[model samples]
Target: MARSLRYFSPRRECPFITIDLGSIPESLFESELFGYEKGAFTDARKAKAGRMEVASGGTLFWMK
Candidate 1:
């Protein structure tokens, strides 16, 4: 169903991001979902776009 939605989405040029909530630890879920600036964390040497950011104007699917 997710694949089908992506296939026919109007925002086909945008991305389709999927995150497995079951695999990620609770402590890190926020950053992973919403992203963070550089130096936001001990290991965040550079800014990185999170799943939601990457899927901007597109589809964001979270699976447990």
Candidate 2:
């Protein structure tokens, strides 16, 4: 079975950090989850930190 990722806060402390993934674009797959290099793809002009990197200090819930 497969599951769509949902970020859940155990304590429900910060309601402001909500992410409605329904509006997320498909193009953000690798570039978001996995780190990407500068010019990794055609549209990549700068090295941007991916979500995995951003979630380093915290928890990352990967549905798949």
Per-model lDDT: 0.89, 0.55
lDDT of 1 at 18: 88
Could you tell me the TM-score of candidate 1? 0.88
lDDT, candidate 1, at 8: 82
Worst 10 residues of 2 by lDDT: 11-20
lDDT of 2: 0.55
- Residue 61, candidate 2: Cα error in Å is 6.0
Provide the RMSD of all predictions against the true structure, rounded to 1 decimal. Answer: 1.1, 6.9
> For residues 1-64, what per-residue lDDT tens digits would candidate 2 score against the true structure?
1112223544333222223355556777666666688888898888887666765555454442
Whole-structure CA lDDT of model 1 = 0.89
Lowest summed lDDT across 10 adjacent residues in model 1 is found at: 5-14
